[model samples]
Target: MSPLDQLFSNYLPVFLGTGIGAILVISALVGSRLLAPYSEERNKGTTYECGMLPIRRASTNVGMRFYLYAILFIVFDVEAVFIFPWALSYLAVGPQAYWEMVVFVGILAVGLAYAWKKGALRWQ
Candidate 1:
């Protein structure tokens, strides 16, 4: 068989599944919009927050600390993702894999310690 045909045959189930999923999602969305009731009540269109009408524009300045905390969380979260696969196969891969993970985690630990010392974890 040709390589092109062989490749498609191998991935036929994946392609069919993806196409079916896309169709199902699109149909559900279109069906909901078509079948759902349309209403034009006066209060229904207004934004409600904490059962109180909004007095001003919703846009507000966020603190820089919030972004710093978020970035730190993302960095550590990605580190943990790499560690998971290494841990699952650590036994078969032996000491070299174990030491590699240790160095990876140790570097992160140092960074965490630095952040702690700098008061990044503190919320005020």
Candidate 2:
């Protein structure tokens, strides 16, 4: 009947669930260590890198064009994603939402234009 009792009842489930999950995870990990193979090779030169040569110094200026294009692609891809949700709800959301999208897209267009002007797109 009391506010304190109601709040405690609501929060008690979350606290109990978290404590149970933690205990189970710790027990499973300890059990696994006992049952699993343990290896200690201090020199780990063969750490996974897509089966490429384990020793190679990368030249820093190999090609920034890839990174540049990736960034631009993500930027416009995000713009398209935003447009989709807005377009889907446009009829239900009315013209105010549409106007908001126009403002959002205008900002994106300006940014893309600035990048273009700054020669970020030039691969040379």
Clash count list over all predictions: 0, 0
Residue-wise lDDT of candidate 1 within 1-124, one digit each (tens)? 9999999899999989999999999999999999999888988877879889888777788898999889999999999899888879999989999998899999999999999999988887
- Best candidate, lDDT-wise? 1
Worst 10 residues of 1 by lDDT: 53-62
Could you list the CA RMSD of all candidates, in the order they appear?
Answer: 4.2, 7.2
Residue range 1-124, candidate 2, lDDT tens digits:
6999999999998999999999999999999999999887865546666767566655455687888889989998999998887778998989999899889989988988998999997779
Cα lDDT of all candidates, in order? 0.91, 0.86
Please report the TM-score between candidate 1 and the true structure.
Answer: 0.62
Question: What is the TM-score of each predicted model, taking all chains together?
Answer: 0.62, 0.49
